[model samples]
Target: MRAPKSHVRVALATTLLAGAALTGSAAAAGFAHADSSRAGDANIAPVGRADLHPEASPLFSVARRLPKVSADQVLRLAESQVGVRENGYGGGTKFHDWYMNSPRARETVARDGGKVTDYRNAAWCDMFVSWVGDKLGIRPAMGWDAYTVSHASWFKENKRWGTHPVRGAVVFFGWDGGKLLHNIDHVGFVIKDNGDGTIQTVEGNTGNGKVEIRTRPTADVVGYGYPVYTA
Candidate 1:
């Protein structure tokens, strides 16, 4: 016998409601399963904090309020380290320690046939620039070598080498007028163009192993390596 039209409608509606309930329950269970899979993972945040509730977290608020790093900020960071001095001859200064603590420090030391512990007192002008780059998140790609020649060559091969000065560019120096990627002796971060064929720079391991802000004639600069910074 054919059921009443109203009864058929009610039956269909009941089936749809039951199906929806089952689907919702399955979805919730799946979410729970996924959450459990990450239960002991140290990188996973706690349950209440797992979601992206930036407004609810103080850390996120502080991060949001922090200023964006630009070329000017990078120059400032280099300037702030200007007064750092080496402790002795072999290794011990904060600047050297900073470089040694960098993620690639071990590789750099090994490549240079240097002891990791002795890197603190090495001719670290290049390492200082590298550390600054690492802090600014512009390194490795910007060339993180502790050797000036290696760093300059990396820049040249990457097409970042130039003679023109840009603020925050890495300046390579060769005391004997050696070429840019060869015989490079020291490196520093350029602060500004003096407009008189010179540039002001903050350099490490200068004038008795102290970081100093100094003026260098453009003629002494073999080349400038520009970092890929947005600002």
Candidate 2:
């Protein structure tokens, strides 16, 4: 079944709250309850903690590096991506759908009886990175995927993004309480952090695929993940 935009936001928020030592869904229920002051505060006042898990990799060190890119930049980058045609359920209503059809992405989805249709899941993140990297002439991936993977593990292992949920920080989720179950299947970016445990998140596949910005519950956050983008 196709995921609902509201549900996706809920899922993403739920995971982050759960990470903040918030208990139960009620602690940070709904997109309206997400707060980012703690995250924002961390950005203003960076702190350090011992790596609880020796084997686990650290959270991306460059989450605060460079000014956070604007939503327009992200959109422009997304729109310029080259999409590869295939077949599947077009997930959302994003305009970026016009350019995210990566050849390899299309080929992979076609094998699953699906086509590359939406930016949220069509390897669009990679495509977005590709476009932005080539245009800005910087390294791609921005450590988005790797940081997400590690952050999911960090919440499971060390239980921290080790930083604040700033713009460009990757938000991740899983089945209720399962952190490692994260597959980059769902992703969003922090846009605004209201102090009252609520946040505004600009996410893909949200609000029927229009890249809508919505409020999220922060107290139930399971993890605050980030990508490494060292200068």
Candidate 3:
């Protein structure tokens, strides 16, 4: 989570891998109350942690032309990014560059009380999710946003929020492993439910700040947002 100003910075914990810290699901099917602020730890902050990194910013690059793809293709596309990492302080990767220039960034900045540039190296888990949606040419159905709470709220508003894990579902997580919206700490795609009260997921901005496949207990999930995939 971004710690700049009123935004809360998230302290990582072992909600994910054992002895490791940090880490989603549907609409509000199993959730009791989900406010917009409960996006994710990375979702809520305008900037993450303390900005200890000297700002060696990259020159803005043009967003790539997105190729139209189907929902069935999203996992493959998301999987292809498995090893990508930030250039530290969240500045590297096509995700940051794309979000920096997109109209969605302007929208988020308008509502979230931050300059567009403050996102330069801000916590970027949600940005990575947005990037994949744009890449697959499904931004409307797949949805996109910098803040996970707002993004998850979008799904709720659209009546897409739910409780169960389905392949390709956008997952919302709370650090406390509870069902409240404000506790949400991260976002990712559900690969599958392991059926042992565990899930397999691919997430950005995790595990030393790289995209990783992780096994997490269901207790950590706030819910899932089901993007309309057939569009």
Best by TM-score: 3
189-213: candidate 3 lDDT, tens digit per residue: 9998899999999998898888989
lDDT of 1 by residue, 1-231 (tens): 011121111111111100122223534433112232322233322222223222232222111222334567778888888788777853467766776676555554444454666554467787678777667665532457556666776566444567777787889988878663555678998888899988999998888877899999887888887654533
RMSD of 2: 13.2
| TM-score, per-candidate, Cα-based | 0.66, 0.43, 0.71
Tens-place lDDT per residue, model 2, 114-225, is: 3345344432332333334334422211321212343244344323453355554545543254444344344455565677876666554444333445677664344454
For residue 206, model 3's alpha carbon misses the true position, in angstroms, by: 0.5
Candidate 3 — worst ten consecutive residues by lDDT sum?
A: 14-23
What lDDT is reached at residue 71 by model 2? 39
Over the full model, what C-alpha lDDT does candidate 3 score relative to the true structure? Answer: 0.62
**Clashes (candidate 3):** 23
**Whole-model Cα lDDT per candidate?**
0.59, 0.37, 0.62
After TM-score superposition, the amount by which residue 110's alpha carbon in candidate 1 deviates from its true location, in angstroms, is: 4.1
Candidate 1 at residue 195, lDDT? 99
Comparing candidate 1 with candidate 2, which one achieves the higher TM-score?
A: 1
